[model samples]
Target: MSVLPLIFTSGWASGINAYAVVLLFGVFGATGLTDEVPEALQRPDVLIAAGVLFLCEAVADKIPYVDSLWDSVHTVIRPVAGAVVGALLAGQSGSVPELAAGAVGGSTALVSHLVKAGTRMAINTSPEPFSNVIMSTTEDLGVAGIITFAIFHPVGAAVVAGTLLVLGTVTALFLVSRIRAFLRRRAQRRAERRAGQAVGPPV
Candidate 1:
């Protein structure tokens, strides 16, 4: 029940598209991100698997241009995560209804990922060196979280993930528009102040 809330809240708040992106570049052959940890915590194989996945994500991120390359390769990665989500849902469920759930999961993830990647690309176009790195690291953790949820709690995870995706994308658009308006108003105020100075006390 507790995990259910995490799954639900994070699912919606995290954005489906971003969750998709995380899976796109990170899920393939990477076991730890989605692998279930044995409750016992005594399994050597589980430990090894966890270590390897973390190492790959960490190492890949460190190589200056590797992140870009990874992104390029993941063009297909987003869809694949969706497919996996679909398949998982279908397997756990029965008939057309179950399959539909998978499709929804996959599609939600795809949309969420698209928005997130587009936003990140726009932000990175600026010349700030550290901004991209900081963004990438944060996103990586997000990806890990999504995967963990997908693997461990499919139904609850799907509901939460889907909700988060919708909420995030919508909220992001609202925030962006608000910020632009604020900036425009600020700019106008500055212009008015400048004109007042030039007018020289209305004389």
Candidate 2:
């Protein structure tokens, strides 16, 4: 039951459309992004922080090197978030069991982060803006679903997560394959276009 809550809550917290935001939060500090979004951006700090992070994500996602940079940073992030949240919760109840729970929580976050990074890498390989948008949207939906499950039914969330973790792995492989094919096709098309232009369209 406890494990379920951790999984579900973490899952939901991993947003799809808000992946960059969530990831940034994970990279920077978990609390800022883990809690609910602020009701108003009236506060200067909140507004500025949000803007900077979002912009960084926007620019980073587009630049190949920067995308790698984001991945490198986030590699340490997700696990920390999981660990922090777990530790906080464990503090509430001082018990050996609780300590174990915290470890589990932190580990879960790490696993989630790895899966997410894999997906982003696959998605970013394509130069098509639409593909990134679509994948991002899909990720947001997955995160939302996990959150909803945590709130409503934890048992269900665990089952779903276990299933998805397996599926996510498969999906990662599939995405990698598709992205490679797409890149290859794009390169061929670009070469053809350049060749045609050089020949003056064969008159």
Best candidate according to TM-score: 2
Residues forming the 10-long window of minimal summed lDDT in candidate 2: 33-42
Pairs with steric clashes in candidate 2: 12-147, 16-139, 16-140, 17-140
Residue 74 lDDT in model 1? 49
Alpha-carbon TM-score of each model against the true structure: 0.48, 0.57
Task: Supply candidate 2's per-residue lDDT for 124.
Answer: 65
lDDT of 2 by residue, 14-117 (tens): 32223433343343333453332222322456546655776665556555445556766866665655555445444433432645655666666666666667
lDDT of 2 at 78: 54
Write the residue-wise lDDT of candidate 1 on 145-177 in tens digits. 665655556566567556656666786576566
C-alpha lDDT of all candidate models, in order: 0.49, 0.55
List candidate 2 stretches off by more than 4 Å. 1-4, 7-68, 93-96, 174-203
Model 1, poorest ten-residue lDDT window?
Answer: 1-10
Kindly report which residue stretches of model 1 are placed more than 4 angstroms away from their true locations once superposed.
Answer: 1-69, 93-98, 146-160, 170-203
